[model samples]
Target: MAESFLFSIAESLIAKLASHAFQEASRLVGLYDNLRDLTKTLSLVKAVLLDAQQKQEHNHQLREWLTQLKTVFSDAEDLLDEFECQTLRKKVVKAHGSTKDKQDPGVLSIEDVGVCF
Candidate 1:
């Protein structure tokens, strides 16, 4: 159960990392390098998770560690969600302009944000 959950989270994060909106957001936020590193790290984690899942059947410590890792993955997922939301909001504002032309300080106004990758 834990393995499947973790696998799903990793897959979701990887998909988000590859998304056009997220890629643009990362570039605007100057996280292109960080995003590349994260992609590599998550690939490693997914590889290790397969072995860990098999071994965890007899190792209580490994199970506990997986639980802790789940929390970390949850936090990472939330962070990616925030970036995706901010990027999408910026796109909407740029397409239609903000309501009443009131600028949102939180949403960045980026023109022609090219993806680093």
Candidate 2:
């Protein structure tokens, strides 16, 4: 009977050890899966950061282009204004010359009534 009891006790100990080993193995697998997920998350974060950096560079370039375009537009406007002034001056000179030819000698000059600078 003693020998039988010893065998039973040994069997119980073996079963407990097996159950503990299984629990440990399950915990290790869970830890490994968590580590894999963390790695993936880190990779995704890195990709996002890289994309943001590229976008920032693009925005900087766009701002520079916009500034250059504004300068060009300002220069064009100034040139247009200068051209318009020249055309207006020519028209006024032509009109003045034509009016002078049509005026009578007895007429008083309109400029005589104005204050002299």
TM-scores for all candidates: the values are 0.80, 0.34
Q: Cα lDDT of all candidates, in order?
A: 0.83, 0.45
| TM-score, cand. 2 vs. native | 0.34
Question: Residue pairs in steric clash, candidate 1?
Answer: none
Residue pairs clashing in model 2 are none
Q: What is residue 76's positional error in candidate 2, in angstroms?
A: 0.5
Runs of candidate 1 with Cα error greater than 4 angstroms are 100-117
In model 2, the worst 10-residue window by lDDT is 1-10
By TM-score, how accurate is candidate 1?
0.80
Residue 21 alpha-carbon offset, candidate 2, angstroms = 96
lDDT of each residue in 1-117, candidate 1, tens digit only: 898799889989998898887777779889899998999999899988888889998999999989998999999998788767666777877998865446476754443243311
